[model samples]
Target: MDLGNKLYTLRKQKGISQETAANEIGVSRQTISKWETNSSYPEFDKLVLISKLYDISLDELAGITNINNKEINYIPIKTHYEYISKRKIGNIPLIHINIGRGFYKAKGIIAIGNIAKGLLSIGLLSIGLISLGPIAIGLLSALGGLCIAGVSIGGLSVGIVAIGGFALGIFAIGGFAMGIYSIGGAALASKIAAGGYANAPVAIMQDTENIKTLILNKLPNTPNF
Candidate 1:
C-alpha cells in the first residue's frame, strides 16, 4: 500500500481531519494532503512524531524493508572479549584483549562495521568542524552576511575554536563525549600495558629486571618506565 493510503487510513481511524493532523505535527494541511496523495514522504523527524501519534512502531510506519521482530541491527553488547580475542583475516593479524584488560577494547572493539565505530567517526567529523569553524565564517563573509569581509565573523584565529557560538555549539557536545571516551580509553590502556609489562613471563621479565637492575646498579632514580 502507498504511504498516502496509510496516512489517510490512520487519520480516519483516529477520527481527525487532515488539518488536525497537520496542526498536531506542525506541518501544513497541504503537506499532509501531499503525503496522502503519495506525492511525497514525511521528513524523518516528522515520521517519528507521526509514528507516536498513530501509536505505531517506526518500522511499521515506514514499512521497513524486510524488517523482522528479531532483527538486531544495533545491539549494544558489553566487552565480551571472546568475540574480540582471536582471529586472522586475510593476512592481517587481529588485535585482542585478555577478556578483562588491554588496548584491544579501548575504541569499543567489535565486529567490523559496528555502528558504534561509525558513530565515533561521525563525531570526529563534527569535531573537525569546530576546528574548521574559520571556513564556515569565510563562507558567511562571501555571502556578504557579515558586517565586514571578515569582521567578527566568529571561528577565526584561536584555531577555529569559538568559545561560545553557533559554529561549534552543538558539535561541542559530541566533541566532549568523544574526548572523554578517547582519553579514558587511552589512560586505561596505559595502565593495563604497564601492569602487563610488570607481570610478563620469566624471560621477558628477566629482560626487564636485568634492564632495571642495570639502571639501578649504575644510576639511581634517574630512569623512568
Candidate 2:
C-alpha cells in the first residue's frame, strides 16, 4: 500500500473526523484531505505528530513492512471518556464527567474531571458554590491545597474566614495569619490579635514588646486566646 492509502486506513480505523485530525495535527482539513487523496504529502514534523496522534509507529505510518513483507496490524486505543446525565437542571446537565489524555473541561450542576466548573465541582482545578480539589475557588466554601472562597481551608487560603498554613481574611487562623481578628503562631491584625507571637492594637500574647495593649487575662465575651 502507498503512503496516502496507509494514512486513510489509519484515520478510518481511529474513527475520527478529518477536522478533528487536522486540529490535532495543526493543519487544515483541506490539507488533510489532500494528503489522504495523494494530492499532497505531510511534512516530516506533521508526520511525527500524526504518528503520535494515531498511536502508531513512524515505520507503520510510512507503510514500511516487516522483513516478511507483511503489514502490521493496528488497534484503535480509547484515549477519552465522557458522560452526561439525562437529568437536566435548566439547560445544564445534572452531572457531567469528562476525563482523557488531553484537556477536557466538565461543566454541569455537579461536575467531576481534570478541570471542572459547576454548582458543586471536584477536580484538579475547580470552581463552584462548594469546590473540593487541589486548587479550588468556591463562592461559599473551598477546601484544597490553594483555596479562595467565602470560607476557605487549605495550605494557602484567602476568604472571609480563612484557615491554612498561610491565611489572610477578615478572620484568619493559621501558622502565619493576618486579618482584622487573627489567631496563629505569628498573628498580625488591625483590631485584635491572639497567638504565641501577636501584633495588634489590642494583643493577647506572652511577648509584651510586640503588644501595644497587652491583655493578660481573657476578656469577657471573648474567644479563648
Candidate 3:
C-alpha cells in the first residue's frame, strides 16, 4: 500500500483526528488531509515525526516487508556491477553517493534525496553555490526557512543582502531588520535606516516628511511598501 493508505489506517487505528495530527507536526489541518488523501507527501522530518508518533518503523510505514523468492539461479556479474556501482546518466549521475555530478558539469556534485552536498546541489537540505530546497545553504544565494548566504531570503535570513520577516545583513529589509542599511518596521542600522521605529546614524521614519528622498538615496532598489 502507498503512504497515504498507511497513514490513514494508522490514524484511524489511533482514533486521532486530522487536527490533532497537524498540531503535533506543526502543520495545517489541510496539510494532514493532503497527506492522508495522497495529494501530497510530508517532508523527511515530518515523516520521521509521524513514524515516531505512530510507534512504527519507517519500513513498516513505507509498506516494505521481508520476502524471498527463488526465480533466477544465475545472475550476470557485469549487470550487477553496472547497475549498482558508479552509475551515471550522461554526465550527470542518476544515483550519486560520496561524489557525483548533477545536470550541470561540476566536480563533487551530489544530487540525492533529503540531503545533498556539492558545487551545485538540489535536495531537501542542500549545500552548494546555487542550492534550491526547503532548507538551502547556498554560498551565493540561499532561500529557505532560515538561510545564510551572500544574498538570502526567508522567514529568518542572514546575508550580505537579506530580506525576510527578520533579517540581518549589510543591507536588509524585513519586519524586524538589523544591518548597516536597514528598512522595515523595526529597523536598526549603523549608517542609514528607515522604518516605523528606526535607529541609526541616519534614520527616516516611515511617516516622516521628506522621507521619500532619503529612501531613494539610501535604498534605491528597495521594493515599495
Candidate 4:
C-alpha cells in the first residue's frame, strides 16, 4: 500500500484522531491531514520521531520492502580545511594529499587517505628527479599538492616542474595553487585539461593532466572530507 493508506491504517489502529497525533508530534492538524493525503512527505528527523512514537522502525514507518537500506554512503572526493576553533591562528585552511594509509593508534583520527596518496606522489617525484627524467618529475609535482601540508615541512623541497607546451612565464609556483596548475605539464594532465577542466586552487587533484583544481580554504566552512 502507499504511504497515505499506511498512515490512515496506523492512525486508526492507535485509536487516535489526527488532531491528537498532530498535537503530540508538535505539528498542526492540517499537517497530519496533508500527510495522510500524501500531499507531502515528513522531514527526516520528524519521521524518526514519528516512528518512535508509533514504536516502529524507520523502514517500517516508511513501508520499505527492503530490509537493508544502506543509503547515504558518503566518501569525500575533495579536500577540506577548517580553523583550529580555540585559537585564531591565521588559519590557512589545510588540505591533505593522502600519501599513506594506516589508522592512527593514538587519536583514532582517520587521515582520509590524503596523506598517504600525497606521500606516494612525492615518492614518485623523487625517483623521477633522481633518474634525470623531467617528464616524470613534472608528473609527480603536479599531483603532489594534496600531499602538501604543515608549516614544519618548511624545509621540504616541492620540486615543481610544468610539462606542457606552454612557456614557463605563464605559470609560476604559488604554493599548492602553483603545484596544481603544473598538472597540465605532465602528459597525463594533458588528457584532463583537454576535457575542459578549469583552474582552481586544488582541494583534491584527481588523475588528470594540465588540469588544475583549486580548493578554497574558507575559515568556518572547512570540509570534514
Candidate 5:
C-alpha cells in the first residue's frame, strides 16, 4: 500500500535477497533493509534504480494509481512466451521456442531461444547439428559471429572448411587465413597458398616491394590432383 511495502513486495516477487537488491542498486544491504522497514526513504535516483532492477515502471513501483483508485499492493505479472510442439522424437520435442526478458533455454529437434541446443538451433549461444547464433558450435555447419563446425562461415571461423574475416582450417578463405590450402589478403599454408601476400611451399601471391616470391618445396606428388 505504501512505498516501503511496495519495495518489499516487488523485491520478494522478483526473487532476490535484500543484499542482492542492494548490490544491484549500488547501496548497502542495511540501506535496503532500512528502506523496506520504512526507517529511511530512498532518493529519487535510488528509486529509479530500484524500479529498473525490479523491472517495474516508476508509477507501478510507487503505487501511484490504479483503475479502482485504490492503493495498489500487488506484484506486476511478467510475461514469458514459450512454445513446445506436441510431436516429439524420444524425450525431446520436435520444436521448442522460448522467448522472454530473463534467460531461457530451448532444447528440441528445432530449438530457438536466448540459449538453444537441438538438431537445428538458433539463439544467442547455440549448439547443434546445424547452429545459427552470435556464437555457434555445430557438428555439420555453423553461421555466426564466431563459429566452429565441420564447415563454418562467420567473422572468426574454425572448421575443416572455414570462410570468414579470420579463418583457420584445412581449406580456409578470409582476410587473414591459415590452412593447408589458403586464399586471402594474407595467407599462410603448408601446401598451396594464394593471396595478395601468400607464404607456403607452393605460394601464388602478388609481387610486393622488397618481398620476394618464395617457392620452397615442390607441389605434393599425389595421384589425385
Candidate 6:
C-alpha cells in the first residue's frame, strides 16, 4: 500500500489515536489525518521520526517492495548555504581552514587544537596572553620549549624575569643563567650574582646574608623579602 495507508495501518496496530500520535511528534491532529488520507506528505526528517515511532523500516513505508521493475525517480533537497561554513560560539570564532598548518588558522578568545592563537591559547604551537604549548608565546607569562614574554619559564626562556634550563633576561635563574642578576649552576651577571660557578662584579661564593643584602639593595622597592 501507499505511505498514508501504511501509516494508518501502523498507528492502528499500535492502538494510538491520531491526536496522541500528532502530540507525540509535535504536529496537529489535522496533519496526522492528512497523512492517513494521503492528502499531504511529511518532511524527510519527520518521516524518519514516524518510521521510528511506528517501529517500521523506511523501505517498507515507501512501498518499495510493491513497485517491482518500476524505475524510481529521486529528487535532491535544495539549500542556499555552505555546508562547511565558519561558526562562532559567544564572542569566540571557531574556524578550521584545512590548508598549510590549518590549525594555525584558528583564532579566538580561548582556542585549543594543534595550533591556536587567542587570549588564552593551548596547543602544540600557541600564542596569546597566557599561552601553554610546546612552542608558546605570551605577552605576560609563557611556558613552553622556547618561551618569550615579560616573565617566561620554559626549557629555553628570554624575558625581563626568566626561569628555565637555559635562561637569558634581566633577572635570570636556571641551569645556565645570564643576566644583570643571575643565579644557577653556571651563572653570569653584571652585578651581584650567586651559584655553583658564579661570575659577577660582586660574586658571593657561599654567603647567604651578602646575597640577600645585594638582592635587596638592587631591588630596594621589592616587597616580602
* Greater-TM-score candidate between 4 and 6: 6
| Cα distance off (Å), candidate 5, residue 128 | 0.3
lDDT per residue, candidate 1, 1-225, as tens digits?
456787898889999999888778765566689678875566566778888898877776665521355432321222322222234455322422112222222112222211112111111111111112222222112111111122212322111211212112211111111111111111111111111122211112223456555545544644466
Would you estimate the TM-scores of all the predictions? Answer: 0.31, 0.62, 0.48, 0.30, 0.63, 0.51
Model 4 residue 107 CA deviation (Å) reads: 49
Q: Write the per-residue lDDT of candidate 2 for residues 85-122, one digit (tens) a residue.
A: 66789988898876656566888999987899999999
Candidate 5 segments exceeding 4 Å error: 1-75, 207-217, 220-225
lDDT of 2: 0.82
lDDT (CA) per prediction: 0.37, 0.82, 0.69, 0.38, 0.82, 0.72
Clashes of each: 0, 0, 0, 33, 0, 0
Leading candidate by TM-score: 5
Q: Which has the better TM-score: candidate 2, or candidate 4?
A: 2
The digit string of per-residue lDDT tens for model 5 on 109-190 reads: 9999899999999999999999999999999999999999999999999999999999999999999999999999999999
Window of ten residues with lowest summed lDDT in model 3: 75-84
Error of 2 at 26 (Å): 29
Reference-based TM-score, model 5 = 0.63
Clashing pairs in 2: none
lDDT of 3 by residue, 182-210 (tens): 99999999888889999986798856777
Model 2: residue 22 alpha-carbon error in angstroms: 22
- The true-structure Cα RMSD of candidate 4 reads 20.2
- Candidate 4 local lDDT, 42-117, one digit each (tens): 6666577677777777676776642356432221112221111122224321222222222211100111122222
lDDT of 5 at 208: 37
User: 3 or 4: which has the higher lDDT?
Assistant: 3
